[model samples]
Target: MEENRLPFDAVILAGGRSSRLGGVPKQDLVFHHATLLQRALAASAGAAGTVVVGPRPEFSLPGVILCREEPEFAGPAAAISAGLEALARHCTSASEYTLVLACDMPLVQDAVAVLKEALVPAKGDGVMARSGDGTLQPLAGIYRTTGLKKAAEELASRGTLNNGSVRSLLASLEVQPVTVPAGSTADVDTWDDAAALGIAAGNQDKKPGPAQPQLTWEARS
Candidate 1:
């Protein structure tokens, strides 16, 4: 869309088979009273259009464009490349950037802004999420059009190097870190992890126990 004014496109990485989450897609799981995919979409409001990259040929998403990984089921790199290519094709502007976000991260908002701040036009690539101590988050990073094309081409020619992992591509990129805020990197992989994160975040939303009121001995006073 208007990538010129922070209008970069968005990619929702929902390609994971999610075997850890009982062999079902984690994106379809309930989170914060909504499907994980729905929450991810809501956070991508700045993107002009969104694409869901998955392996299921019959996959469907209402109001959002759907595209399967080019060499469906290859791995994360394949999914990322396919999503970027799809975004490029759909976008009229040839120079716009694309933000790649994983579907399982329910607390990764403000990522786009962090990326925008770290983007150095002279550097050719934008920013990516890094942990508080600076660990790159490739799946939740901003990718410039040129960088994305290069990454895709490399992936194609190398037959998906680094075991077809997005981490490999991210490591090779000229990346900058968007230091994650405290408690913002919670990703729901195993059901256990989901439960833990849910409990933590849910607890944060509630007020702490107040001072215990004095018990009244008088009956029905």
Candidate 2:
């Protein structure tokens, strides 16, 4: 943590209707002996407070705030709004930014740290992770708390938040993109994605004990 870098509070969005993976809750999926939600929480261990926005998580984590977007399964934008509301209670003058993450990204910690470091060199509303193909992974980024709150609120007020896209929520903010490694932006939406990430297939989804790390971000050229 640098003196100039804002203290981070985090919001993990876990409430999605996983229609692609036979309705399995992505947050409940295992990765390296931990649930996807747990891995996400571990990554935010440095934050002042962490909020998990979704239906009640299967596992309990002390000091974590669990919330859900209004109307349920209301997409990322509404989920973000729900997270912002939970965060408002815990944010202080020292907590200037929010680290937003999607629960399904299993290997996002390094990129999370890198995004934090990027904040030191680039001044913007936030530092977002960009995929190799140049798509913005908005959930894998740090945002100024005030700016995010405003954006979330504006979208909700406009009545477009239910199942709304994240891009709409962030349309007004000046976000700097830091290109992250491939799997850092990978999210599991289908069974193939899960299996590719070391998650067992079929009846073996719970083959548990602990799986190994499936990918790591390589150094930039």
Candidate 3:
């Protein structure tokens, strides 16, 4: 690892149903000439190892370990567990920290940078991103490997890993929140969100439609 960089692994959650986006996979959505998933991969390019947790995409992804949650689309918590297991199984050495990211956020690179910088001086279990609007974004956080494993184990012990909320997985961790730039934590959950972020559906073939009325960012549910 570079002297200025910390050794870490990355787990990207890409298994959402996209129910609000007419079943279009958000990972396939394009922004700035790259799919959302590709953008996420680029954001975590510095990690020693990366595991993408979700249904395997049709296209090839070089140098990435791909896996799915036990029940498939179970939830972020379950997906995270599977990613951690994949990392342990495939990587020769474990990193001290893990980056957990949601692929739907196109501008996550900014958040990652902020979290990583904050982590250097942080004494907590990890550092989470707080959006400019003050919303805590756990999915954009970097966490201590041991802390994540412990939390996953505790959730599994209670039989709640599957379909469990990300909040539950981080409930026991001591995380410092660092504010990120505006729109850094914005995620594409709906067509309106895609428009707000200037993303286009990758599978669409229609010509560009009339300009969409501007919409404000919606809080993640």
Candidate 4:
């Protein structure tokens, strides 16, 4: 792919029932010192703009477009649909591919390159990032708005949107699977999950997660 041939937009799914964290907004929850949304934004900043789908707007960032779901919300699927709809209205084409990343992932590294390499289909296509363990990480993946619209519309028409989750959506399309490094796919869901990331990142509960100096990821394009 050429340097500027970005084939998709990135949608960061922040709308979720963070019941595990006492119903706290996952995007607002801080990991070490950075908020989850901040980490997510940093991870997705270079992926053609970011759209945050969530209920609360209090944690809104500068560059991210915060959008909540309609119909009182169903789940991530609903939020994703809402984001896609809004993105479609603003963009030139609604058929453009979108990389839908969950906001809870603190270990997302080089998302632009990962999604770029994973987006392998001609015309319109979908892709998902898989960990070294081979589990299908549905949230950290891609979805064409056209494909999502089809499924969402169908489900909405039937008066039953229960079956149109991200997992089912990817199953319905020819999705490319990209392999991420071992520790780059942790989705900080529960309190335990965040704690584990802190421990792994060399930050215990008392101390904060110090930003490690590295030459792997450059600050600029």
Which candidate's lDDT is highest? 3
The TM-score obtained by model 2 is 0.87
Q: What is the C-alpha lDDT of each candidate?
A: 0.65, 0.79, 0.83, 0.63
Which residue runs does candidate 2 get wrong by more than 4 Å? 1-5, 90-94, 202-221
Candidate 3 residue spans exceeding 4 A from truth = 1-5, 202-221
Q: What's model 1's lDDT at 63?
A: 42
- What is the TM-score of candidate 3? 0.89
Which of the two candidates, 1 or 2, achieves a greater lDDT against the reference?
2
56-155 per-residue lDDT for model 2 (tens digits): 7544456677777888988998888888776675545437888899989989887787787788777879899998888889989888888988887787
Runs in model 4 deviating more than 4 A are 1-3, 57-60, 92-95, 120-124, 162-164, 199-221
Return the TM-score for each candidate structure.
0.78, 0.87, 0.89, 0.78
Between prediction 2 and prediction 4, the one with superior TM-score is 2
Better of 1 and 2 by TM-score: 2
Clash pairs for candidate 4: none
**Model 4 per-residue lDDT at 170:** 53
Residue-wise C-alpha lDDT for candidate 3, range 1-221, written one tens digit per residue: 24136799999999989999998888778776567777787788788888888766545566688888889879999999999998998889879999999999989988888787888889979899998778999999999999999999999999999999999999999999999988888999989898888876554432222332222221111
Worst 10-residue stretch by lDDT in candidate 2?
A: 212-221
Runs with alpha carbons beyond 4 Å of true place in candidate 1: 1-4, 55-63, 120-124, 161-163, 199-221
Ten-residue region with minimum lDDT total, candidate 4: 212-221
